[model samples]
Target: MNSGMDPHSEISRNLRAVYQEVESEEIPAHFLDLLEQLDAAERSQSKKDTE
Candidate 1:
């Protein structure tokens, strides 16, 4: 197996496959809500520090 495939090409193909699989996944709504909460907290902290 993989006798004639260039090593670089093989690596590239594998990476693309993995990327596609990850890209097709659905992010949970709770994860998105958590991210929003984190952003809000960071902004609040930044504002307090500046004042």
Candidate 2:
């Protein structure tokens, strides 16, 4: 059943708008610190696996 408007296009437009809004926001400092901690843990694990 065609509704005369493409639902897929409407969804794509909404998703793009949401993405643009999110991209403009600043990341919190605490979140950045957490991410850095995670990266360090991953690197430590990788070094252990190689040895």
> Clashes in each model (backbone N, CA, C under 3 Å)?
0, 0
lDDT of 1 by residue, 1-44 (tens): 76676747878789888998988889989999999999999999
| TM-scores, each model vs. reference | 0.54, 0.51
lDDT of each: 0.90, 0.89
| Candidate 1 lDDT for residue 44 | 100
Candidate 1's displacement at residue 35, Å, is 0.5
Off by over 4 Å in 2: 1-23
- In Å, residue 11's CA in model 2 sits off its true spot by 15
